[model samples]
Target: MASLNVGNLGEYLREQRRSAQLSLRQLADAAGVSNPYLSQIERGLRKPSAEVLQQVAKALRISAETLYVRAGILDEKERDELETRAVILADPSINERQKQVLLQIYESFRKENDFETLSHADADVDADVDGSGSDARPKQSPPSS
Candidate 1:
């Protein structure tokens, strides 16, 4: 992960929990975690695993990717997707539940596309993940002064 303001994630989490109108104990119960643990998470004293984050997102009726982005756990691909989610959340018209529904639909489509791509990977396409070798994408040339 790149550089991120990881400390502010607790404030963000606290704000989200409050926005959802859930008490600390309530969210902890909903996320199937202990109250003190959830409190610690909100205080930035601990980092939750992906599974726990997913559970918290479900309890908050929000995207797990949001939590992942906040915690600086996303890869380049997910970071790109996070930009879209941020746009959606920034829109003042949609409420939290609406945002959740939209995110769910969007995520389903992405998952479907990912499944299709993986299932139908071209046997002839032998590009390395690091963009090395015979692949033909344009490369930056040395700048002439």
Candidate 2:
């Protein structure tokens, strides 16, 4: 576990809530936490677990990894690489083999830079077991003037 930076995390959460124009109660309700608990978290008087942090991130409609990094749950570099890998894996335009090949190349680059390489299993991706990839989009017709 990374060292907890409760103060920084609290301040960041406060700022994000304010930026989203949500009150403490609103955020708490949305995050499925008690109002006082959320308040304590924001005031740096309590350390929230990752689950709570994830709920708060969802309520804020922001990246959960950002909150994780601020709360010392993940390193900044790890978050960056994780996000990149997630994007690569989620791209429906690429086939499973192509995605795996791209990940191998990406991991190699990271390894060359002395970064810890993450396995494919570390990402939350739906496997394309059918061997078919789709990047389907609804066709949009031009508006008539």
Candidate 3:
């Protein structure tokens, strides 16, 4: 399995910034950082703190949680999500907007699958509660044999 790579965070950030049509200096100003500092961050030469990532995320009009995951500040089940997005963003096969579209579709599919799974699970639980599931309920004897 591929290990997590925070280096891709820089590229992802840069992609987000550009999609917003913000130049390096513009993003730096918006995020309250020096231009050189932001440049270093985008170049993957520097790792930004949580606060910095938050500020940058806010400036880009995106969720800070995404930045937190990318920065390795929020390591948990969220890592898979962020890493999947990072890989999508890094893929050269698709362009930026296409990547965004694909990500949205992927998320929707996951949600739909989860919903279906839960619905099935809930049906099973309901059946159990009602003792109506096959092999669960008591069988009756034949009458007038």
Candidate 4:
């Protein structure tokens, strides 16, 4: 039999619920779903509808859009928009380099209102080393000697 690579929406939901320190029963109660049904969904035996996914996401304190993406239900443009928004929202403390990059991105979007024109090369300016380790920033060279 051919193998199937089903969506991981259920797994993602389960993981998020666990991370939030909620039990299956608690999550089901909060989500207004049946415990057994939630369990089956977590075990990959049942696929949840978009409405259920949104409910679960609300109960888990996660974005419904993210759940939709995990469920493979979001369109390409929506997925990209969600991913970009996630990047901006994931980090609360923006370092100087990150702030600069964000500013540049904002300016570029303001000028053209196009994200496709933004390139990794355009953002590579210097090396950013923080507690999280090194990430390549836009390359900046020393002033001429």
Candidate 5:
């Protein structure tokens, strides 16, 4: 029998948990799952159901839609639809630059939907400190000539 690739739900969960500084045991306890089960899931040896994924996402303080996306329940088309809806739901006053950035991000996400591999470094947000004491925002300045 052919094995099914359920996408990277487990790895996504594991990364999110680690990013949140939570241990496997801690995540398992909070998600009402066993450490071994969680470990297997993280290792891609087991697949979790939607309900379980939802519970785990809730425990990790992430949106269930994120979990669904990781689980391959939301395909590229659906994700694009959601992104379009989200952009529409945002303030109409948003500038063209903001829309361009959002489109770039969405395209990058769609192109790098691999489960086993991490997305490109473009997904990372750089923190820059200005001498003017403003909070760090996304690095949008053009490179010096």
Candidate 6:
């Protein structure tokens, strides 16, 4: 019953195709999809599956994971993590060992944040169950007569 967010994916695909100097028909041929179907996808009249997106990404010489993220198949957090790892791995200044260490540290920090978020949520739930609202404001006494 809900509309899927495919418009952004379509726009992104069009942009990538254009940037690669390829026409809709050419891209469709390269991606092994029909021209009309690719056009429909670009117009947001169709939602392509992950395999289709992967084929398109290959035709465009782009990352399939990026397309997956734009197509809403992957979470934004996953994209962020992948991008961070890519940056770290691509940095020529860092040695391979250093890059591995940095990635390990980054992963640990992410896990720590996830744990803290869960702990805070649990605390809020406990506060609600105990008949004290989740708000942390201190209770105030009425003014004396």
TM-score of every model versus the real structure: 0.52, 0.71, 0.50, 0.53, 0.51, 0.78
Q: Please give the lDDT score for candidate 2.
A: 0.86
lDDT of each: 0.83, 0.86, 0.86, 0.74, 0.73, 0.90
Q: Which portions of model 6 miss their true places by more than 4 Å? A: 1-5, 134-145
lDDT of 3: 0.86
Which candidate leads the pack in lDDT?
Answer: 6
Predicted candidate 1 versus true structure: per-residue lDDT over 22-112, tens digit per residue: 9999999999999998887887788888889889989999888878878878865887788888988888998999998999999999999
Residues 10-72 of candidate 5 have per-residue lDDT tens digits of 667778999999999999999999999888778777778878887898899987777777777
The local lDDT score (0 to 100) that residue 6 gets in candidate 4 is 31
Instruction: Give the C-alpha lDDT of model 5.
Output: 0.73
Q: Residue 111's C-alpha lDDT in candidate 4?
A: 52
Clashes of 6: 0
Model 4 worst lDDT run, 10 consecutive residues: 124-133
lDDT of 6 by residue, 67-91 (tens): 8888879988998899899999999
User: How many clashes (backbone N, Cα, C below 3 Å) per candidate?
Assistant: 0, 0, 0, 8, 0, 0
- Cα RMSD (Å) per model? 11.2, 18.9, 11.8, 12.9, 15.9, 3.6
Which candidate number maximizes TM-score?
6
lDDT of 4 by residue, 69-132 (tens): 7777786667666667567657779876785688577557755754444643334432233322
lDDT order, best first, reads 6, 3, 2, 1, 4, 5
Error of 3 at 22 (Å): 0.4
lDDT of 1: 0.83
